[model samples]
Every structure is written in structure tokens, then in C-alpha cells.
Target: MLETVTSPTLLVSERRVRANLERMAARANRHGLALCPHFKTHQSLEVGAWCREYGIEEITVTSLRMARFFAAGGWQKIAIAMPFNPREIGELQVLSQRVELSLFLVDSKGAAKLAAELSAPLGYFIEVDAGYGRSGVSWRDHASVRSIIRAAGHHRFRGFYVHSGHTYDAKTIPEIAAVHQELLDRLGELQSAFSDLHPIMAIGDTPACSTQEEFRGIDRIGPGNFIYYDLTQVQLGSCGLGDIAACAAVPVVQHKGEEIIVHGGWVQLGKDSLHLPSGPTIYGRMVLLNQDGQWDTSRPMGTVTKLSQEHGTIHLPESLRAEVRVGDLVGVLPVHSCATVHGLRATGDTRFLA
Candidate 1:
């Protein structure tokens, strides 16, 4: 049933993509919040256009290059969620003139320096750590945050923004809600502390955004990975397999015992792994596809147990070995959608995205 496909390919279901976008947009609108989805997920101009169909004019991207790409693609407002890049000062200055550009600031001194360097007006947000253990001002670093907020005097201060990454560690919905409540409480305190400034809340990260039903005081939510929910999101209970919009199609090349080797590997999908319900840690789950190459949600065949640079070996049960064979095309759902697409864009063939 899969003889024509000659190489590894990432297949996206337009139906699921649109449905995900609309679902998030509606949810944000219901909560009276802005859904500026991160464009770093798909990075395709075509995908950007799909977002526009839902009346999403404001968007988020990781780098200045992506900001410019989407800006030229007709996105009216863009927030570069990453830290302000000194190397792209010139490009940042240019992008600000063309669109409403925003960046993340962690240091007061750095904020002042950027305000002085940027020729055009720009918006800025103080990066709040929110227990992510990554970049951002720690919730307890009130003194430093105050200094940065003051230093961002001339520049447009957007407010306190955070990537609710701690929710990623949560394995259940209750755990996700607990982390969300703590962040919300901290955000509330920030709002009151800076009452004179009246900053808006910008909370992001897909785990909390998708699982939690409430948004107490959030002004905007940017859940990037929800566009293509992956194995990790499923394990975290953010979404189901039916909600996963993308799949990788690889040509099966060998069968050693019960394992089926495919042409796709780490370069095709990222090295992210997840422990499945069946109690096996695998890079990606072997998914089934309909005749149209769309995802078949009925069942997953197995898991990609081992991966080399150009080969992935999936462990299938004896009952399903005959159902799949060498020279056939198999479907895989990556563990992390973000890393997978980035890998494809970074090292795959030029025609990979198409």
C-alpha cells in the first residue's frame, strides 16, 4: 500500500491543523485572552496563512529571522518570545519599524542598553521564571524585576510574561492545575505590586494552556506545541492522539526478528523520547495511516525503540509483524513536535517541508 513514496517525509493533516487552531482560538476568546500562537511550530508561510483564517493577526516567533518572515507573511503584530539578541540589533531595529515588535528582557541594565540601541520604538516584557529553572526573572527576584521595569521606561513595556514550563513536569491534570494556580497567584501579586503601571499577564506553554480550563487574570496565552500535539503532550494529558496533527512517513527497509527498521531516524524526527502506556520508552510511536496518508487514530502499531542517524527500529508485536513489512511506508508520531520540525528544517533535504 506504500510503494510510491521514495524518501522520509513529514506529513501534516490540514483537517487536524485547522481544528486545533480554531479550538485554541475559541478557547482564548472565551477566556477573553489573546491567542498569539507561536509560529515557530510550523515555520511555513502556508501554516501562517492557515492561522490567519481564524482571524489571528498577532503571532509569536522565537528569533528575529522568524519575526521578519511572519511579518512579511502579513502578521501585523509579533512578539519574539526569546531573549533580546544583541547580534540582531540592526535587524531588530528594522523589524520594529515594519511591525509591532516585542522582545523579552531579563536584566535592567540590558533593558536600558537595548532602549538606547534600538532606533525605532519597541515593546518589551520582563521574563518571569515561574519555576521553569530556565531563563527568566525568578518570582522572588522582585528587586531586579522592579529595576528592569523601571529601566524599560522609554520602551513599550508589555508586562510580566512567563513560559509555564513547570507544567511540563506534571504527569496529571491535577498536577498541571496546581502549578497553574501558583503561577496565577504570583501573577496576581505582580499585577498588584505594579498597579500604577497596570501590566498585562502573558502566560505561555502548552501543558497548562491545554489542560487547565480557567484563566484567572491572563491577558494572552501562547501555546506553541498544541498545534501539533505529540507523544509528550499526550503523556502529559494535554491532548489525545486524535489531536496530533502531524506524522512522519518513513519507508521500511529491514526486519530483524520482531523489529522493523525504517529510513527515518533522529535527523527526520528529534531524539525526544517518551515512556508509552505499554511501558516502553521510545523516540516515537508507530502510528497507522489511512489510504490518504492521514493519521488513523484507531491504534498505534508499536514504538521506535532504537534510532541511528538514518535508521529507526520499531518494536512491533508478533501479531502485527505480517500487517507491516519491508518496502512499505510506516507512520510515526514524534515525541516532541517542536524538536522534530526543527530537525527537519535544520538538516533534512531542501524539499523536506514541501
Candidate 2:
């Protein structure tokens, strides 16, 4: 039955996407903040249009390529999330001419110089590393920030942008709240130091923003994962299993000892793993299917116990494995829906969505 459907299309239900957008917008409005969702997660023009339906005109993208893609699609206010790459300065200039473009700068020296060179009227965000340890200037590094701002000289300094990706690891609501508050407090200090600068403290992530209390002092909240909450969101307490907006239909191709083999594997779903005590892990949880294209949580349809380049091995019970024959379509609940959908190049190829 599954053989009739083409592979690699990511299907997203319009209803789920809207529900997530409405909830986020309401939450932000309640707390006095604008919602500028990140487009890097899905990067779909169709989904981007969906965001506009909810009064979101401003957006954040991870690359200049994404900026070009959406700008041509009609987005006006855009903040390129990552630090500016020198190689892309020309593209940035072209994008700036079309829309209000903002660049992220971590250090004072490099950013100051770039701001001086930009041909168009550009905006700036102090990319503060609020304990995430990945990129950005440290919140405590006052000297570094002071230099960057001074270097900006005359450009529009739009305050700070911090992504607390570490919040994904928080075990409790209190933990998530604590990290969120700490990051905000750091931004608060910067806001005070640069009072003339209209501070737009921006933060992103589904767990920290959705699972915790109202986020204060944040001018804009960028939550991409909430649009398609997944199994990881459920485990992190950000969302329930019912909120997951995306899934893949894989073809069951074989049956081994207590296992049902499928063609869907790491490359299809992603090579993501859950942090199990035994050791590192790969693949995500699996969901069995019914004729209605919904979740059948009846049996351990497959453990997703193993995978290779193009094949996934599902460790299943003898009774269930016997029921699933070759060419059967099995729905998979992704560990992270964002990673799963980003892999799909088109929407028409996914059977579950159509």
C-alpha cells in the first residue's frame, strides 16, 4: 500500500500550524512582546505566508540565502540570526536595499568595522551569549560589547538578541524559568547601560518560551519549534504528544526476528538520538498506523532500534510484526519535527499529509 506513494515529501497540516501560531501570538501579546518567528526551521514560503496571516511581518532567518528566498517571496523586516559572514556582505547590501536588514555581531571590533562599511541604513543586535556557549558575546563581557557598540558609531543599534538553546536540557519548569530569567536579567543590564538605544531583547526556543511563565523585557520572542512540536517537546514538558504537527509514512519492507524492517532510516528521519543512560542513541520513537492515517499506539510497532543509509530496522513484538507485511505504510513520530521536515524538499511527496 505504501509503495504507491513517493518518498521525501514533508506534509504539514495547516490546522496545526495555525493553532501554534495563534497560541504563540496570544501569549506574546499577553506579555507585551512582538512575535518574530524564525524561518530557518521550515523555510517554506507557504508556511511563511501562514505566519503573515497572524500579523507577523518581522522575521528571523539563519542565513542570507534564506533572507534572499523570503525577501523575494515578500518579507520586509528580517534579522539574519547568525553572525555576518564577510563573504556575504554584497548579498547583505542587496537585501538591505529591499528590506530592513539587521546583522548580528558578537564582538565589538569586527562588528564595528562592518557597520562602518555597510552601504545602506542597517540595524544591529548585540548577539549576547547568555550561557549557551555556542556563539555571541558573553553578557558579562561588558568591554567587548562597549567596543562593538562604539564601533557601530552611527548605525541603528537595536539592543540584544540571545538564544538560550541550553534551555532545551532543563529538567523542570523551575529550571527553565531560572535560565530564562537569568538571560533576561543580563539583557536588562545591557539595556540600562545603553539607555539611548531602544532595547529589543529577543529570545527563542519552544521549551523556554512556551513551558514557562510570561517572558518579560523581551521585545520579540522567536519560537520556531512550537509550530511543529514533537516527541522531544513532550519530554521537555513544552507540549503534549497531540501537538506534534509533522510525521513521516515509511514503507515496511521486511520482517526479521522480532523486527519489522522499513526503508525509512537515519537519513530520512534524521540521525537524532535520545540521551539514554545505556549510551548514545540514534533514530526516533515509532508510531504504528491504522487505515485512517492516525496514530495507533496499541503495540510497540517498532523500537526504531537500528538504521543504515536507506533502511530502518524496527524492533517489534512477534504478534505485531506478523501483522505488518512488506509494502505496509507505518507512520513515524519524529524525535524532533523541525529536523524531520527540514529534510523534505517538497510537500506533495509525503503520503500522511496529503
Local accuracy by lDDT, each model = 0.82, 0.76
Candidate 1 per-residue C-alpha lDDT over 118-183 given as tens digits, one digit per residue, 9 for 90 to 100: 756688888888788899898778899888877766888878889988898888999999999999
Tens-place lDDT digits, model 2, residues 1-354: 334564533546666778888888889888888899988767778888888988898999898988999899999999999987877777788778899988898776667567667756689888989899998988888888888888877777887888899998887778888888888788788778777767788898788878766666778888888887877777777877767767777777876768777777766777666664466463666676565455644456456777776688877766675677777777677787766776554333544342
| Per-model root-mean-square deviation over C-alphas | 2.3, 2.7
Where in model 1 is the C-alpha error above 4 Å?
Answer: 1-4, 347-354
Q: What is the lDDT of candidate 2?
A: 0.76
Error of 2 at 102 (Å): 1.4
Best-fitting candidate, measured by lDDT? Answer: 1
Cα displacement (angstroms), candidate 1, residue 302, comes to 1.6
